[model samples]
Target: MYLNSIQLQDPNHYMQIAQSSLLPMLKGALYYTLPLTLITFSIGLILALLTALAKISSIKPLQWIARFYVSIIRGTPLLVQLYIIFYGLPSIHITINPFPAAVIGFSLNVGAYASEIIRAAILSIPKGQWEAGYSINMNYSQILRRIILPQAVRVSIPPLSNTFISLVKDTSLASLILVTEMFRKAQEIAATTYEFLLLYSEAALIYWIICFILSIIQQKLEGRFDKYVSH
Candidate 1:
């Protein structure tokens, strides 16, 4: 009976801790995690589009440069990339703040992986479509902008959405560089409270909730795009 009462009290204590920490952690997520994901993914998507175009372009140098960039980014672990930007660059007297460093690392990583998806989507468009565009006296740019990219975007949606979701989780890595994101908030709270399991679980729940919401949004977007494509 005494042990049971102690267990009940412990839960109440943890509950209070959760209630207290939830707001600050949520603030961290809102202020840092979401912003990092949006900024990096937006920048990365542009880089990916350019890289994809370069990969398919006739210019040998452009293809080579794009391939090299993709190889370097894909070959290295993202954590190492973050370390290089945040830690190693200081050795060369080039320093970036924690947020910018995370942005560069995550953007480069996303660009490499997403470029492949974009390139494949672009390539998957039937050659006949391009021929039709040319038959209509459309220039290469017109063909791509009007015929190719629209189709490619439809095909790329799922994979790119997955990448965006992954980026949200990856933003937790920013904590290692002292970026004070959601997971960092949990860590700080845990350190003070010495409640590692409870705090970390709460943080994990928050991340899962964010990802779950994103997954639903992805499904909705995919359905909307599919409907558009079918028409």
Candidate 2:
């Protein structure tokens, strides 16, 4: 009725762990992962739209800035980038906590990549569309806000949703900086109880469930949006 390494009078230590550690760990994941993915991805999408516009702008400086940002983020590993922001920033006067720093780094990285997706979508919109928007007395911003961006978003939805799903899983990496997400909590429980297999497996189960729910939402959104595609 006890683990060899400890003095606990519980016959169902393993089963108890499945209920105790897993249920809350899943909630912790939802707490961090859902907000991080949704907030960061939404902000990133806005930044991406601006960056994409800058990339194609007639102004050379804006174009250069967009290209450089995309190059640096895309060329480097996200973990290293995160370490620099989370750990390296404190070397100077700029000190941020692990969670905020992770969010910033993730949003920036998503922005860089998503900018390209946005740019490609915008570029794919026909010249006639642009001309038509102008003929309708739409200014540049108005045309983009109304005519262009709507189509671009529709075209980019599938890839952008995939990026969001990946971001949900990637949020686990924030645990390395001591964010105490689901996986980190799982590790803590495993270390405390020596129930490594049980706790870790439960953590994996939680991740799968979270991702599955996101997948269902993504599918429903896709179906709803696809109705507009051919019409």
Per-residue alpha-carbon lDDT of model 1 for 1-231, expressed as tens digits? 777676444678988999999999999999999999999999999999999999999999999999999999999989999999999999999999999999999999999999999999999999999999999899999999999999999999999999999999999999999899999999999999999999999999999999999999999999999899788
- RMSD over all Cα atoms, model 1: 2.2
Q: Give per-residue CA lDDT, model 2, range 1-231, as digits (tens).
A: 356778765768677878888666877777776787787898899889889999999999999998999999999999988899988988897988877987898899899999999999999999898999999898999998898989888888888888888888888888887787788888888888898878878887877887798899988888878997867
**Candidate 1: residue 6 Cα off by (Å):** 10
TM-score of each: 0.95, 0.91
Looking at candidate 2, the ten consecutive residues that score lowest on lDDT are: 1-10
TM-score of 1: 0.95
Candidate 1 lDDT score at position 53: 97
Q: Indicate the worst ten consecutive residues by lDDT in candidate 1.
A: 1-10
